[model samples]
Target: RSIHVDSPPSVPSLTTSYVHGTSSVSLLYQTVGQRLDSTVQRWPEREAVVCVQDGIRRTFSQFQQDVDKAAAGLLALGLRPGDRLGVWGPNMYEWILFQFATAKAGIILVSLNTAYQANEVEFALKKVQNATDVAFKSHSLTSLTQS
Candidate 1:
């Protein structure tokens, strides 16, 4: 009885490799925030953002600064990392930015559907501590309802 053994196939070597720069999540976030803030400061007169509503355009740069300030305000409100905050409202630019802001602050952002009923809102808020509801579209702080 004769048994024959076959040679294994040869594998090709990897000649090229991709290397990513050291961009830590925290560092990247700080860099982006600093860049945006610096640009806004440098071109204070220029429009940084525009809000198009009802065919009307509202210029912004100072507005952006204010948002960062407000987000920081939340950080100052004893809301530390992992703390969950709620933003209940229609889909708007502020809501999007709030998510960014929450990430920057390392806080958890729990968005609430504007169409949610009282029970839904209650359930959402009850699950987390330090939950603050922000009504940014209202333009007035009086509209803010927190639990």
Candidate 2:
């Protein structure tokens, strides 16, 4: 047996059940690239990243420099702003750099699951490529594996 309510679905009332993200701290409206730049300026020499297994370490200044170069490299590869690039890999330092560089270059970086096969990657890339509404631009699908 089914019972029906007379009234249509009503919005949740803002009482004990409703909680919001709004807080006393004012929001900082800025992009990741912008925040990175500011942090680099404030503490260029401070340690920004460290990967013991990879034997990699970078200060804020170094990280910013590398990110800039990486972003430029992406543009040089013929990927214009809004073009989709896929990066598939296990956790590594390069992932961090790509995260910032993509934002700087304005290229949309698609995170491909490390478990995805080649066909899956191709399908995902094609979806983004089609959305771009342009003739086939260069597809940069780089994969990295942890040692």
Candidate whose lDDT is highest: 2
- As a whole number from 0 to 100, the lDDT of residue 68 in candidate 2 is 86
Give the per-residue lDDT of model 2 (tens digit) for 1-147: 344444544565675655344344555698888999999989999999997766778999988888888788777767888877777766677777777888988887788777878798778878766333111222222322111
Cα deviation at 44, candidate 2, in Å, is 0.8
Clashing residue pairs, backbone N/CA/C < 3 A, model 2:
none
Q: Tell me the lDDT of model 1 at 22.
A: 35
Best by TM-score: 2
TM-score of candidate 1 against the unseen true structure: 0.52
* Alpha-carbon runs more than 4 Å astray in model 2: 1-24, 130-147
lDDT of 1 by residue, 11-81 (tens): 54556543333322333345445666666677766765455542222234654555566568778788887
Regions of model 1 farther than 4 Å from truth: 1-48, 54-64, 128-130, 140-147
lDDT of 1 at 121: 86
Q: For model 1, how big is the CA root-mean-square deviation?
A: 13.9
